[model samples]
Target: MAGVGTVRSIISDSLGRSVMAEQPPKIVILTAPGEGLPDGLEALSGEAELLVAENGAQLRAALPGAQVLCVTDFRTNAISEAWSAADSLQWIHATSAGVDALLTAEVRESSIPVTNARGIFDRCIAEYVLGQIIAFCKDFAENQRLQQRHEWHHRETEPVTGRTVLVVGAGSIGRQIAQICGAMGMAVDGIGRGARPGDNDFGAIYAQADLISVLSDYDFVVIAAPLTPDTEGLFGAAEFQAMASSARLINIGRGPIVRTADLVSALQDGEIDGAALDVFEQEPLPAQHPLWDLPNVAISAHMAGDFIGWKRALSEQFITNYRRWAAGDALNNLVDKTHGFVPSTTNR
Candidate 1:
């Protein structure tokens, strides 16, 4: 509950301590109002200089002397400006689970170390995926629609128990989904870049090549993979056609990973039963978009992993990494420039 001035003083003190020890590094926060900083950072109050920017002008002004910039929104081009304006800037931390939006060509080419909120949204997103799957399986949407019409309808519903779920990209979030799904008695299958014996925590594991062959067997398919060169346009007409006519797909990963046009065609043709998508190729999904009117498709405003405590979770991750950095230790969750993140080598 510290005031803004108190937070500013704490930041100044932290920076002063670093400067006196010949390692001064200014910190700038790029987040919307009401997003609380981590508890650990309260101790840094009076130790580092902190500046909060809400708009382009304020953001640019705050960047001139910053050494680290923490970004919460990727909508602005201010990131590039900040990099150009601050010669001392060496690290960039994204407060979201995915860093795709902030991975601009300029930022990627720079030597600055970049990290993301990798593990923060795992449980939250898993629960969301689970809810969607159960809702779809139980025909909750249809029941709700009937209720609004004042029609009494009762029907037997399918259980998730013993059903199969195929999860693409067994990362932290994907593994969490698998675990929760398994707890509900659903068989879980995961596909990733490399499939080693006894490597996955999910019920079953397969390599990327097995995706098309196994598409027809699952009751639910969840795409939680990162957007990389190999994953762009990975799910298109052919993959959709390969799925069972009764299967549904859920995407909580990068938007472009699933082709919009192909998905539209599949939904129109009834190629697949339904879809619950939280991400899209174009955000705010234009008003004219056909996906909104599709009967079997459920579209969300990219908020599946966004929850009340998300900001605090993100800030806590930064604080933990900051402590490591201050102690002269290697940063955790380092992005692999070659592959976004090294799957096999890094600990999830």
Candidate 2:
């Protein structure tokens, strides 16, 4: 990665918070090289000093001088390495939607507020989930195989209109998914920590305690919940056993939310008909992994929520909140560190 030098100016963007402070704040951006953030960030260079760090060493060095940290690489544990050095950091913003990797004890206990790019990825992930549902119901995997073999084989595909779906999370992303699935005529059921009457998106809501009993009733099970103490290992052998044999599982949440071995075993035993896994316990899912060989599984490289220009969207969102933060107004998409996600109350 190339080193980026900072250029300071005194001009602040008019869009920034209306409030004025005595001095320009120092902001550090932790990002990989060659990625595009919004172009207009330079306009704020006058209001705040901007520093870019692409790796842990640089991040640690930059942390000592910054009041705000923009973490473009959520997977990096550099925050922990530089926590002691972040004497001036008052706020931390993560570009990625999930903050599981950033929820270390040090960050959790820090007085600094943490926020994430949440709603930006909601629609992208919802569309991906819908696509997976259709693919599984239509048996697109077999269709592709037949195409490769040049075999004129004919098979009956299932209709998704009357099928049922269990959305295991009621956050913005899950609600968006439920809305889409419901509109398409699939019965949408949601499970949340505190289940209540659903809106147009969710056809019905179920408490976590009712999950196992209803597992066998749905044809698709989707995991979109954040990784929290209560939701970790939420799906295991028992849950898999409770699912109908024809049900397909789609996981887009944190990898640790679902147990890998149990999922693979369920597939092997024909406990579930298929799976479309966009996340796993281990990312880049080792090349030798057995899931790759499964005929009934669809695998993606953790890109369900990534669309064209998504990075820029994340950056722009940060900039909007940056303006609000600089003005001392309420920030958007603030996270409740204890739950490892933006609290549902905030989203509503």
Candidate 3:
């Protein structure tokens, strides 16, 4: 309501033919302070007016008259703070798959359409999840530890084959995990918004409401769901207690989806065998966090979907969508603001 104005339409002329307006649409690229701008954005030169904003002040100045917002820094709150200045905003594209950080009350309640880099991260994140699953079953963590002490101790390790995996979110990333894991002879099931049978990637899809009731059945449980009101703090003591004691947990999803203190308690109490966490409630995790000292946990700096050339990939996806928008074509990865994600319609 702050940006009160009729939504601007730049896709066509009075004739209704798909065409760019006489004036190229202005695109505002938002980045974090000290972070480099996304690569390959020079492609937008001559096609549109490109403005860069690294903070709320810059963004507020850039938002007026800009029709498209490209959020390269998904973690920033600058958008929310500057939403009132977005008088001309018609679309917002998030470089990251998750748009939770960008979905402020003003942005969500507004009529502006939001899109994300959904397909861009599916394979990379799936691979990261698969690697963690292998590490846990093969005892790769212990192997590295014994090597550090220069000790040669024989030990039996579990096999990933024949193990059961439960993916808590049946989105594109989760399906990719199922595809790769199923290729390894493990059985995979998925949890989604509703129950369904005969899913292409998963053996069966169970409604999210059944999550805790079915937790004890799997050897591994993965959190790949986006962070929403329904999913935040989804995994805690009660959920951990529902899993098999031999089960391991892997989370490549947004942090805060799993409660930090509860996860620490679960690991300390041996409620679960181990965990591999890429995202956390607090980034950098603080030097003295108990999770760092725990041998059963694998920690990463929220880099699961970030691979070499990822920045360029994000830029390219934005460019592609921009072209579509200019030509009045449907943009890919459009997020449903109500649900907080692009609802998964196909298995990737």
| Top-scoring candidate (lDDT) | 3
lDDT of 3: 0.89
Q: Model 3: per-residue lDDT, tens digit, 174-231? A: 8899999999999999999898787778998999999999999999999999999999
Candidate 3: residue 238 Cα off by (Å):
0.5
lDDT of each: 0.79, 0.85, 0.89
lDDT winner, 2 or 3: 3
**C-alpha lDDT of residue 108 in model 3:** 87
Off by over 4 Å in 3: 1-21
Clash totals, every prediction: 16, 0, 0
Order of candidate numbers by lDDT, starting with the best? 3, 2, 1
* Tens-place lDDT digits, model 1, residues 1-348: 321112122223544652222334568877655554543456555556767776566677888757678778755566665556666666788777667656778778889888878877888899999999999989898987899999998789998899899999888888899889989999998998866456446766788988898899998999999887888899999999999999999999989999999999998898999999999988889999999988788888888888887766667788777666656577777776656652445433
Which of candidates 1 and 2 is the stronger one according to TM-score? 2
Q: Score every model by TM-score.
A: 0.85, 0.89, 0.93
- Candidate 3 positional error at 281, Å: 0.8
